[model samples]
Structures are given as C-alpha cells and as structure tokens.
Target: MEKYWNWEGNYIGVRQKDYLTACDGIILGKFYGKEIYDQNGNYIGEIGKNNRLIKNKTKENFRRPGFSFYVKGTITAPFKSCDPYPMIPGYEDFLR
Candidate 1:
C-alpha cells in the first residue's frame, strides 16, 4: 500500500489497490478508475489533475459515510512515500 499525505504533509491514509484506507484502518472510500466513491457508493470525487489524491468538485460528500469506525491497526507510522501534490490555488473551497 502507498501512503498518502495532505498538502501540509500530514499522513492521511494508504491506497491499497482500489481502496483508500485511513490511518486508523477504516476503509474511507474506493476508486473506480479515478472516480472516488464512498463506501456507500456515493460519488465523491476523482483523483486527477496532476495526480491529486482526491479532488471534490461538488459541495456534496462533505461528511463521512456510514462506515465502521473501528481501528483495525492497518498503518503504524508514515512510510516512505512520495510527497503529495502541491495545493492548488483557490481550490480548497471545493475540496471534500
């Protein structure tokens, strides 16, 4: 699994195949190609535009979906990974 970080370099989660697993081990969402969907199958965002891990264009999907919050101990610490893409100017408002 490849670890992902926010624009501030904070470890957010890992990308295991098609799923984005949080640091606490909860599966945050899944990727259908570059399109991201919540565990409930809601269209959230797409991973695109200069390799952005996620880009939420709509105001919807701002809240977490109904997924189990149990920590399954998937990630222990930040692993060696590439730095996240640079933050886009004026794009934060559309973030998920």
Candidate 2:
C-alpha cells in the first residue's frame, strides 16, 4: 500500500498500491518508506511510518505545481490541524 500526505506535510490518506490514485492532477511517485517525488523529480517531502512529517527532509510550505488547487482546496484545509500519529485506516499496524 501507499501512503499520502497533505501539502503541509501531514499524513492524510492512503491507497492500496498507488498513492496518487485519488489525486486529480498532481504527479507523484512513492520512493520507499514515505519519500515522494514530483513530476519533474523534485524531492517534496518524507513521511514516517506513523504518518508524521520528517521535517528535516521535507520542504517548507511545498506545493506541487499544476496541483496547487487540489492541495490547497482538499488536502491541506481538512487535515491541517489533525494529529499525525494515528495510522490511516488500512495502515494500522503498517510495517509491523
């Protein structure tokens, strides 16, 4: 399975194999653990197994080009204030 994070670097959701399955226009790829890359190969962010942002490796206020709307509209707004520790639904006991 693949995990997803919001623009502000909070774990927001997940999919079976493709993390971008529900994303509308963002182009990203999973690169082991929680490293994600943009369409042009920019290292955007890294998420922990517990679904928290690894600040040192993540860009500040990073938003993918051409996909800012999706990030600002849906991904960031809702989960901005939520905790990052809770494992998303299917990821409970993930990597255990």
Q: Candidate 2, residue 89: CA error in Å?
A: 29
The candidate that achieves the highest TM-score relative to the unseen native structure:
1
- Candidate 1 stretches with Cα past 4 Å from truth are 49-51, 58-73, 79-96
**lDDT at 41, model 1:** 62
lDDT of 2: 0.39
Model 1: per-residue lDDT, tens digit, 6-93? 4444455767767777766677676677666676667665555434455554635554344444424365455544455656653441
TM-score of each: 0.55, 0.37
Shift of residue 27 alpha carbon in model 2, Å: 4.6
lDDT of 2 by residue, 1-96 (tens): 445554344434444343332233233433334554444445445565445434333243454433232331113222233443543432222120
| C-alpha root-mean-square deviation, candidate 1 | 4.7
